[model samples]
Target: MNILYIVGEFPKLSQTFILNQITGLIDAGHHVTVLAKKSESNHKIHEDVSKYHLLDHVIYYDENGRDSKFFKGLTFIKSIFSFGYSQLLHKNHPIHLSWKVLLSSPNLILLYNRLKKEPLLDIDVVHAHFGPNGLLAHRLIQMGLIRGQLFTTFHGYDMLRFIKQKGDDVYTDLFQSKTVLLPISNFWKRKLEGMGANPARTIVHHMGIDVDKFEYHPIKMSQDIKIMSIARFVEKKGLIYGIQAVSKLIKKGYNITYSMIGGGPLEKEFRSMISNEGLEDHIRLLGWKTQEQVIEIMKESHVVLLPSVTSHDGDMEGIPVILMEAMAMGKIVVSTYHSGIPELIEHGVNGFLVEERNVDELVHTLADIFSLEDSISISKQARETVLNQYNIDKLNRRLIDTFERKTH
Candidate 1:
């Protein structure tokens, strides 16, 4: 099958889950094209990205003659006149006349021109990663640019912050169209329904990790506790609470070294917190590492800590793929009972869970995680959970089946 994926950015370090799906589809012998607003330059790109030669399949609007301001101005004028002529003939859909499409004409014009140059015009399926992209895809289809079965996955920010900014009726036209809404978790599924998405059309589809790649290695007891967090330094990640909890443990004289991998907008705030607590030695903020590098760090660590909470701006997580990766590697994980995390972690069963932002509870859980007699058992169960439910191989097959089914 030929598939087109529309995303905000390409080859992003923080969103490896999307990369996993793209590579998995390619491995399954499907043609996959990526349409991204822009490409990102990262210190280390994922190996699968290079192995699959994804860059060759990527399309950006700024490419070709669209890069020149003068050319863009001409294109914009042409789009306005063309749209005006279509309106005079009553040949365009209501969406073509909407303010959203009019204001987005510059991007739409460039994207349409870029897509026209592609070898394939009619795509089998167009799977957009976020809600805003879905809206864009809807508009594109309405303008007769691409033909496909539309599917959109609503991940965190689009459901929370985007909805807050655009109001609940933001997806009204999209929800009315023949678009399937796939929220990454039941948590976000509920949010989609709340925003008036057809319950019948909305399905809870999770972003999964490649369990086989993450070889399971049971954790062993150690004196110097090594904990790692693989997340952006953002408020929703509850990283500040993790820092505070680690600092409290250090004050209690626990032999602990916390290593945080990944960087984001709140890096300065988190660094300030680390410094104010005098935890320079105990905590290390290691910025963005490659997938192989991250796996190596996971091997050295005993536990993975991700204390997630709803940010002030209402940003949340949709079952972090990093948590699944750590669990698949048979490492003990301690995270907060927030969003769809509880669906992945059964407290005191496979992994430990504490209330969001409860530093006392987080500290106590960390203090006991090392000395627990069933640490190995918990680690084993964690791997089992991932292998059974969150395996990418299985999830990808299910995704393909859904994509193949004809949408009403």
Candidate 2:
């Protein structure tokens, strides 16, 4: 099957889940063409991006005219000439697009230009990664610029924070037009249903980690504990709380080292807070490591800590893939019972889960893991959880089957 993946950023360091899906599908004998709004940061990308040569199959467009309007106009005119005005205009257009939808054409003028040269009308599925991308794809389909069964996956911010800001009706058109709605967690599957998504069309499909890539090694008890977090420095991550918890533990005379991987808007503020708290020596903020680097870090660390919490604006995590990766690596994980995290982590079973912002509880959980005799057993259970449920190859095959069934 030929699938076109619509996304906000192509080959992003943070969105390895999407990349995994793309490459997984390709490996499973499907053609995937990526359509991204923009190429993301220059930070080192996942090795799979190069290994799979994914950039070759990508089509990029400017979101807000970071490129000149004159160039876009030229591209649009060129597309019209190449495809012929009648074909591009669609003489018997399938849907009646609104003025607002027509207005969004310029953002996709470059894509239209590519379509003129190599039209994707034969594509079986047009799957968008987020709500906004789904809306964009809906507009294109409405304009008769693309022809495929539409599907959208609603991840954390797109459904929670975005809808909170844009209102419940934000996804009304997409919900009505899309053939399927995939939410990464049951938490979000309910949210989509509440926001008017058809219950029949919605499916809870988790973003999975490639368990094979993350080689599992039983965690060993050590005097000097190494705690690590691999997440964007954002409000919802509650990284500041992690820092505070680590500081409290240090003051209480725990021999521990904390390492933070990934970078975001809150980096400067986090750095300042770490300096002010005099934890520069104990906590290391290593910004934006590649996928390979992260796996290596996970292998060395005793416990993975992700103190995720609901941000002020209601942004939250939808079961972070990093936790899945750590669990797959047979590392004990300590995260919060926020959003869909509890679904992945069972408190005192496979892994430990504390309340959202309870630093003391987080400290206690970390301390317990350090001293517990059955730490290795718990870590093995963590790996078992990932292998049983969150395995990428299995999830991707399920996704492909769903796509085939829905499109047919």
- Models 1 onward score TM values of 0.93, 0.91
RMSD of each: 2.6, 3.2
What candidate 2 gets wrong by more than 4 Å, as runs, is 63-96, 102-118
Residues 186-261 of candidate 1: C-alpha lDDT, one tens digit per residue: 9888888887899989988889998878989766868898999988878899988998998888888888999999
**What TM-score does model 1 achieve against the real structure?**
0.93
How do the residues 1-408 of candidate 2 rate in per-residue lDDT, one tens digit apiece? 889999978878889899989999999989999888788866677889989999999887664435676776676566556555555456474544443444445655565554545566878899998887787787677656777999889888998777876677878877776569999999999988988889999999999998999898766868888889999899899989999999999998988789999888999999998899898999999988888888888788998989999999888888899999999988888899898999999988889999999998988888778888867778888989999899999999999999988977
Evaluate residue 288 in candidate 1 and report its C-alpha lDDT on the 0 to 100 scale: 91
Alpha-carbon shift of residue 66 in model 2 (angstroms):
1.1
Best by TM-score: 1
> Which residue pairs in candidate 2 have backbone atoms (N, alpha carbon, C) closer than 3 angstroms, thus clashing?
none
